[model samples]
Target: MARLSDQILTAIFSLQRHLLEGINETAATELAIFEQFGETEITIPALEQLQNARQRLTDPCSRL
Candidate 1:
């Protein structure tokens, strides 16, 4: 049972990382689109936040 629980937790973490990667990609694409439309003021902060979130998601210590 403990082994199963560990497997479940590992799977959840894998899924979380996958989702975060998708979100990061989307954020990057959106930032580029925003730049093309001359919306730096709005997108800059959003991009920064996304970057911070991505960093936190990828950080090993965050899993604890």
Candidate 2:
């Protein structure tokens, strides 16, 4: 099975946490622009969406 490397996942999770901490609209817009081109940019349905999914997903992984 193929999956993202651990380093990649860590970076993604870290980005999620960072984004959730608070981002003004202007910064969010800039991030959205970067995501459009960034190789693993946090593509947003919005950071809240990503954060919700992150909370759900990471919980199970913690048991392993």
Candidate 3:
């Protein structure tokens, strides 16, 4: 279960990073889809994992 969650989170955080790279119409639409899909279908456990991954990826400390 945890492994599955980790995989899902990895994929999601990758997309989330893409979303942050540049914001335009397409990205906005995709981000909206991400929000809906994540909130509705993604399991709570997976969401938590994704959030953690997102933070890690976006954190300045991770860059160094």
Candidate 4:
């Protein structure tokens, strides 16, 4: 069995994935779950939209 911390991380990761996938219902549920788990300070969203994943792919040798 996975360690307790690993399980918590996995659960958090799953919730974040659901949030990223536009599953709006999970946001509140996630918040409540965190609160119940004694994570009251976690008021921010689990995941956020970034400006860009990769600004642009550049060839490593091109910079030389």
Candidate 5:
């Protein structure tokens, strides 16, 4: 039982790490585009969507 619990905890941590990595990559890509293009009519909505996605990714509990 102890070993199973440890495995579960390890898996959870690994999943969280992967999720964070994905979030970071997404933010970086979006930021790069924004930096290169500045803000346009289209980018405004895209930026807002990105911000919301980031918030949800970092704080899934808050949404509930």
Candidate 6:
């Protein structure tokens, strides 16, 4: 089995956190835009991914 390098692991974790935070913020912003303009179908289903990313980031060695 191949081992995960520390740099790769750290980069992956960092990306996860960044993506999670970005998605959560994006979702919130999308909702705001929808509400402000009375538009529909702007849901990106990002919140769930965001949560998953967060979980992955918080849980060490769970990538395997």
Best lDDT goes to which candidate?
5
Better of 1 and 2 by lDDT: 1
Error of 2 at 8 (Å): 0.2
lDDT of candidate 5 over 1-64, digit per residue (tens): 3455888879777778866876787698679879988789978888778878777777853332
Residues 1-64 of candidate 3 have per-residue lDDT tens digits of 3356788879777876665553343445445656777655555555555566556545643443
**Could you give candidate 2's per-residue lDDT for residues 1-64 as a string of tens digits?**
8999999989877866654444334355546655675533354445556456555545543532
lDDT scores in order: 0.68, 0.56, 0.56, 0.43, 0.76, 0.60
C-alpha positional error of residue 63 in candidate 6 after TM-score superposition, expressed in Å: 12
Clashes of 4: 0
Write model 1 residue lDDT over 1-64, tens digit each, in one string.
3356888889887887786776678667767767686557776777677677657656643453
**TM-score-based ranking, best first?**
5, 6, 1, 2, 3, 4
Clashing pairs in 1: none
TM-scores for the candidates: 0.49, 0.33, 0.32, 0.29, 0.73, 0.50
RMSD of each: 4.5, 13.1, 14.1, 16.4, 3.6, 7.0
Please give the TM-score that candidate 3 achieves against the real structure: 0.32
Number of the top-ranking candidate, with TM-score as the measure: 5
The C-alpha stretches of model 5 lying farther than 4 A from their native spots are 1-4, 61-64
> Model 1 off-target regions past 4 Å?
1-4, 37-64
Q: Alpha-carbon error at 4 in model 3, in Å?
A: 42
Q: What is the Å distance of residue 5 in model 3 from its true position? A: 40
Q: Which residue window of length 10 is worst by lDDT in model 6?
A: 39-48
Q: Candidate 2 — what's its lDDT?
A: 0.56
Where in model 2 is the C-alpha error above 4 Å?
A: 23-64
Question: In model 5, what is the error at residue 13, expressed in angstroms?
Answer: 0.8
Cα lDDT tens digits, model 6, 1-64, are: 9999999989988877776666566556656655675543443344445456555544553442
Off by over 4 Å in 4: 1-4, 23-64
